[model samples]
Structure formats: C-alpha cells, structure tokens
Target: MAPARPVVPADLLAAVLRRDAAGPLVTHYDDRTGERVELSAATLANWVAKTANLLQDEFDVGPGSRVAVALPVHWQTAAVLLGVWSCGAAVVDTPAEDDGGLDDVDVVLAEQDRVAAVEELGVEELLGLSLHPLGAGMTGYAGAARDFALEVRVHGDHFVPYGPVDPAGPGLLLAGLELSLGGLVDVAGELADRLGVRAGDRVLVDARAAEEAGPVAWLLAPLAAGASLVVCRHPASDQLKRRAEAEGVTATLGLGLDGIRELGRPAPS
Candidate 1:
C-alpha cells in the first residue's frame, strides 16, 4: 500500500511510530546538568499520550485551545509540544502572560525555574515542567503550580481526542509565524528538503540554533523527514567531533563534524 497522506501534527508523529517504533527518536544531552537521555519513537508516543490525557482530563484542553510553551529546548519540551499538537491545539510561543502575542491561552506550560514569570499571566491552568531527563516531577513546588510529571502519571497510557481535529485549522503561533495544521506539515516537508533531512539520518544539532529554527526545525522537522536527533544543549568545543562519531551522527546543525552534512549550507558547490 502507498503511504498515507499527513494532514495534522498527530499524523506526522503517527508516521514515525508506524515506521520505527523502537528506533531512537530523540537523544538529548545537557551539558549544564551532565545528563543524557535517549527516547525511542514508541516511548515518545507514550509520553505524548499521557500528556495529552492530562491536558484533556485535567485542563479540558481540546481543539481550538491555545497553550503557551515557556520552556527551553529539552526532550520534555519536545513531548509537551507534541502532546499539545496531538490534541489539535495551537502552541503560542509566548514568554510571559502579558507578552501581547496571544489574546487568550487555555493553559501555560512553563519550566519550574520560569514559573514566576508565567504565574502572573493569571491563566486558570498552569502546568510546571521540571525539565527532568527521567520525567520526574518538580521539587519544592508544594501547591504553587500543577506538577506536570506528577499529575500526568495518573492519566491513561493512550489518548483519545474529545472531538475530531480539523487539519486545516490554525496550529502553531509564534512571533512572525502563524500556520495551520496543514501548513505546518507543508513547512516541515520543505524544511526537511532544505536541511537534507531524510529517513535513517542521525542528526546532531545545537539546541540554541534549534530553538531559533523553531519547532518545525527543532522537533517535528525530524519526524516529518524520518530522522532522529542528538540535541546538544551545550557542547564543549573540543568534544564536538568525538561526540558526533560516538553518536553515529550522519548530519549536524551547528557544530562542525568533519565531513558530516550541515544543514542550510550546500557542500562542494
């Protein structure tokens, strides 16, 4: 059978699940914390499901809802974005409650360290992420904010959207960018081609550039192209080549790996 067409964010993730459930999807390295984590497609899907269920059952998040993601580039952030998108909700890339970008958002997902900033948003719902590599709940929060990892565990393993999602509806909302679900898919496809992303490619990327490149490039662009990521939040300059070789990276985003393909720059013109 020919491949099914992708229309929404869920479709893109479903494609990865069907193609490589057990294969590594995201390999995260945090230099600041000396932590590393590798998550497979299936594992990520499960996390997404749990998060979606939490959003649905707890916050009543569904289609047409808006969520402001105030976390940095991390594996948990990846899951959070995918979870929100799976529910057919738009992710508003806002830093604070009074950022003036989004008129009204249903919820705000912020890192524990950044909770104070979003707390002022006055949104009815707020979920705090620990940015933990093992998906652990935040510590010392008490009753300040909803602990994402703690509450998400109570949700079922699978997610079922309350209603059907319209693929042509608005999805991502970022500064200078607004795209429907269909448009997001199209953008991912175009990005994959431009960045030389393809199936079976193990890509090493710098987290800073990934964030600047936006989610379509940092997260879903890889899924959209059947690629896996080795994201380095901060890399020691001397270990770049060694790390790439050790990780079997086929391409790189920012840090130069000898003879490896770099995104956005043509080679041997």
Candidate 2:
C-alpha cells in the first residue's frame, strides 16, 4: 500500500473553514460560568486571525516562536492555539499555577484568575484573558498585563502571515507530549476514524477529559474528521442524555451515550 500523505494542522483548519465556513464548528458550554457560546468556522477563523495579528504585529511573535498558554479548557483557548500555529509558532500549554515556569516562552497567555501569579514571573509579554462568553474585557480588572479581550479586537480580522507555516516545524510542547505541525495533524487524522468523528457528525465532548487529551481531542480531531463539536465543561450528569438528544450528537468523546459512538473506544466487530 502506498504511504498516505501527512496531514498538517494549518491545512486541515483551512480546509474545514472553507468547507464549512457558515456552519457551526464549535459550541461551548461552561457550567461554572453559566456561559454558552457557539462559533461558526468563519467566526472562529476570524478570532484566530485577530489573535495571530496581535502576536505578530505587536509582540513580534512568528515562526519558531514559543508562547506559553496558561488557560483552562475554554473556547478561547482553542482560538489561541490555532492562532499561534497560524503564525507558525509552537504552543507550550501549562496550567496557570503560581510556580509554573515560563522562562523559555516568548510570550504568555494567561487566564484572568491566574494573572496575578504569572505577573510575578516577569515574562516579557503577557496577555490576560477573561474567558468571557462575549469576549469582553475582564470586569474591574487591572494589572500590568495587557488585556487580550480588549486588544485582540483592535487587530485585523483577516490574517496574512509573514511567511508560510513550516509543516515540519515544532508545534506543541506539553509535559509528556511533543509534536511537529504535521505530527499534530497526523495524529488527528489517524484518530479521526477511530474516534468515530466522521463528516457531518456533531460530536459532543467532555471538555474536562478532552482537555487532558490535548488539542487532538478538543480541536484538530474533529476538524480532521470533517466533524463539528459541542464541548460541555463541568457537564451535569443528569442533563447529559437530554442534552445529547437536543444537540443531535452522533458521537461522544469520553462521555458515554446509549446510541452514540464513544470515541477512544473500539467499535463492534
């Protein structure tokens, strides 16, 4: 058999955005904040563009740069990762903790709640996100850190990278995981079918668990399969079944559903 061509994260993202620009690509619900937000492929790309522009124009971050992401499992986190990759930059995702080291990163993107801690790290450039459903600025929030919500919007919605992304370049660096730009996409493509995330399917995911699996389960996997996602954070055990039905979920990642295919599980022979 001929070897299959390698998949690239940027290529997959562009393809999906072109194929389903108007369709909803991500639907997110955060139980803790009682927030629900949805983004079409075009909308998500817009956010990615603005973020990338911010990184490039203001921070001079681009290909080969490493940005530490200190945020939780949130929709905005998705945009941040994609934006960095769009600029050919690698993501260093570490939980926002007081002791987390960001000495190696060119910039740091942190959550509002964790801003105080990272602020003391003396990182060169830091952006604090509120994770607001509307992408609003952090309320009554003030600090030396730049406000991502307020600044990102001022950037252009359409992005033009300084140069093409290098598919073989480093893309991500987690504690126990590492992948090149193409390697990340390769894993996503390989897992797409196995995860039961097929085209036209709406895959419901347990945000908490999916986060543990990294961007593969939460972002690239669905796009690699030509599928969309509904990420439920802090999902209510009682409302899962009803929500699945309401969302027309065809597959699930982590969460078990009676008829829905469960991802990361083998299918019946």
Candidate 3:
C-alpha cells in the first residue's frame, strides 16, 4: 500500500464549518473555571478568523512560522489552535511547564505561568492568556505581547484563508510528559468512519485525550464526520459516563480500557 496521507487537523474543523455553517460544533466544558462555552459553525469561524489576524498582524506567523502554545485544555486553547492553523503556520505545543527547551518556536502564547516558562525559553513573541483585561508592559518586553482575548477582539469577524495548505500539512505540536504524549492527528475521511462518528453526534472527550491525541479521534474525527465534539476539562470517570449518557454521545473516542470499563458497566435502568 502507498504511504498514508497526512491529516491536517484544522482542515477537519474548517470542513465542518463549511459543510454546515449553521449547525452546532464545539461545546467547551471547564471544571477548573466552571465555564461552558458553546459554538456554532459561524461562531467557530469568527473566532478562527480573529485569532488568525492576531497571529498574522501581531506575531508575524505565516508559512513555516512556528508558534508555541502553552495553555491548558479549554475553549480558549481550541480557538488559539484553530487560529494558528488558519495562519498557515505550525504549532509547537509545550505543557504548562518548562520540560527543558522549546524547539525554535517564533511566538509563544501561554498562560501566566507558562509565559514565565516560555520567557526562560527565549521565544521572540509572547502573548499572555488573560481571560480579562491585562495591564502594563503589554507590548514592551523586548518582544511583541498581547492578551489573547483582547487580541481576538481587535480583529474583524471575517477571515481570509492563507497560503496553500494540503491535507498533509503539519497542524499541531503537543506536550509530552508523564502519561502525556502529544502529536498531531490528521483529519481524513477514513478515520472518521472507523470511529463510528456521524453528523450531529455530540462527542464527549477527556482533556488529556485532546492534548495527547491532537485533534484526530477527539476533535477532527468527529467534525470530519459532520458531528459536534464536546470537550470536557476534567475527565473524571463517573462524570464522563454521566455526560455521555446525558449528552447523548453517539460515539466516544480516545479513552483507554479503564475509561471503557467505567463507561460500559451497566447503569441502573
């Protein structure tokens, strides 16, 4: 057999937005912050567009440029990820800590703690993850700096697609640590079918799965199949099981045997 084609994770999401520009898409769940953010196709498109602009205009991220995102699993993370892809650049994701050294990423967008971590890594551009407004030294730290939310707000609601991107393009860079291995999952037609994903299926996935597996089985696979993917911040076994049954999860992916066992045990009927 010929070599398998690479999967560009962002394209899978883009396709869903294009296919049903009016349907439900990503539903964000955050346990730490008790926040739940939902997005329709149109909203996802707008967020991606604004983020792309910020990456382009502020960070100068374009073809071959690399941006390091050191944020945790949340809806903001998703928006930033899609923005990086929209800019036609590669994402270099590191965990919220400094494992060692970052691999030559041009820009670093991270949470407050991660900003300090990336600072030590010597990345050129740094953007802080501020859910609210930020103060002082915003753009004068010998590097371009901006708050994530503010940056998004400054841009227009429309997005202009960037340079040539193939299905084989590099889409994500993921964190690697204890029980955490990260890589990109290409979005293709076949994988979606293999996972029993279908249009309108609300996918409930663990945060760790999304981090480790990139966007394939968790994010892209569902979207590629015309379904909506709901990402939970914390993947408590009982919580996931309850969410699956309550949220009407048609098919779930990225769970290990332990999660499967927890989910499969007969529920009180």
Using lDDT as the yardstick, the better of models 2 and 3 is 2
| Counted clashes in each candidate structure | 0, 0, 2
Clashing pairs in 1: none
* lDDT over C-alpha atoms for residue 267 of model 3: 26
Model 3 stretches with alpha carbons more than 4 Å out: 1-11, 97-99, 131-145, 166-169, 173-190, 235-242, 255-269
Best by TM-score: 1
lDDT of 1: 0.84
Model 2 ranges with Cα > 4 A deviation? 1-7, 96-99
- What C-alpha lDDT values do all the predictions have? 0.84, 0.85, 0.63
Please state the error at residue 16 of candidate 1 in Å.
Answer: 1.2
lDDT of 2 by residue, 1-269 (tens): 54344455667768877677998888998877777899999999999999999999998888889999988878898899999988889999785443376898999999888888888877769999999899998877778899999999999989988988888888998885789988888888888866667889898989878877888767888888889889999998887888889878888887888877888787666
Off by over 4 Å in 1: 95-103
Worst 10 residues of 3 by lDDT: 177-186
Cα lDDT tens digits, model 1, 166-201, are: 887778998867898888898998999988887889
Error of 2 at 71 (Å): 1.2
TM-score of each: 0.95, 0.93, 0.75
Q: Please report the candidate that would top lDDT against the real structure.
A: 2
